[model samples]
Target: MSRSPTFVRALGYLALALFLGMAVVLRFVIGPDVSFTPQAEIGRYSDADLVALGAELRETGQAGLYKFILLGVDFVFITVFGLWVMLVHAIRGLGPVRWVGVALACAFMALDYGEDLMLAIRMGLATKGNLDPAVLTNPVSLVHYVTLAKFAVFALCMLSVYFVSRRRA
Candidate 1:
């Protein structure tokens, strides 16, 4: 709230960079040969897709590694995004509505972490060849919905920042 516009802008840029970088790193750690598509962006995949992905990860022997790498990425992701929401609040000149962006960002972080943990558990089970379709159903659905809500709230926050900034300009 007390931050200058220029400082807020700098934080926003840094957050954007970290967010993209972590995403790219996570993708690479998951391996190029793996055919698994991330459900974070596209929502949940079909049961067959999950099975195929689990098989690929299991065969490639990278599921555990992926879990570790994703955990690190998720950490950076949430930190950077939390900064972004703060930057948004500053850029919006610190109002009650501006705090809504902060609230949404917190929600996004919680959901993001939950999704990461769920995926890690799924990967662990899959690597042990103990994962069942029935087990995949609930967590997968919950993660997808959480991801959708996270994105929706994030988009709203971004829009609020944009409109508010434009108005000030």
Candidate 2:
């Protein structure tokens, strides 16, 4: 399960590139007005808040772009970042602790994907004018909890990377 330093470096560069590209798009293209979407929100947001954001995006004619960023750019970014984290752990030789990093990477990526999927589904329903409260409840709740879980796991992943790097040094 060991990875070469070269491979790890390449993955890190790719992850960085993807992250920067996504950031630029979010900052410039999506802009600040529609920047406060659920995916970017760190904590639990109400169903009304989600609906309001969706409506705002729709009204501003940025709903499609927002969805594209979430489902498209963010998806690629999450996969690349997760793989980079796993590869870094492997390259650093964390011994038994390496497995924990790998598991954290997997959990982080899963939670992120789950959150994105829920938001996308909610957006889709909003776009179609079919955002029935009953249908929205489960997805909204999933997005809320999954977003929190994603952040916690991401923090753990970063801490694991730090520990591995420190051990290597």
Candidate 3:
């Protein structure tokens, strides 16, 4: 049941291409205009900040684009990036190290997805003018924490892969 090296390599390349493509699209094509996009803002943001971002998106008619980037492009990007990380670890064949990298990759993907979903929900509420402070607080906090977790896990995963590959070499 072992996969061929060629097959695994091909999949890794494909995943990388898809991930990069989506990244370009997000960065230059349909991404939000604000510099402090929720996804890029690793630091903690106030509920008020989140609310204002939503409002700005709505006012600028970028709300739909923001939601699309989160639920659509980013969804695909996260999946492909996670798969790419796992495949890289698999190719490295570092036993426990590989497994740890894979686990971290999965965790990163999950946190990213959760962060995007929470942001989308916040945006939806903002779009609907349901800006009750109570309604916004939980999602805003969730997005912030999840985003931080996602970046941390991603960094760990990449470091594990790098160290494993270097050690093998």
Q: Evaluated with lDDT, which candidate comes out highest?
A: 2
State every prediction's TM-score relative to the real structure: 0.73, 0.81, 0.75
Over 4 Å off in model 3, which ranges?
1-35, 125-132, 135-140, 167-169
Residues 1-169 of candidate 1 have per-residue lDDT tens digits of 3335676677678778867776675566664768654534575654445556666877878766665556776677577777777666656645676677677678777877776665555555424535676755653555566667767777876777666566543
Q: Count the backbone clashes (under 3 Å) in each candidate.
A: 0, 0, 0
- Residues 37-104 of candidate 2: C-alpha lDDT, one tens digit per residue: 57557666666566667777788888888888888888898998899888778767457777887899
Worst 10 residues of 3 by lDDT: 1-10
* Total clashes in model 2, counting residue pairs 3 or more apart in sequence or in different chains: 0
Candidate 3, residue 104: the lDDT equals: 85
Query: After superposing candidate 1, which stretches have Cα over 4 Å from the reference?
Result: 1-7, 26-31, 46-55, 125-133, 137-140
In order, what lDDT does every prediction score? Answer: 0.64, 0.75, 0.70
* Residue 89, model 3, lDDT: 79
Report the Cα lDDT for residue 119, model 1. Answer: 58
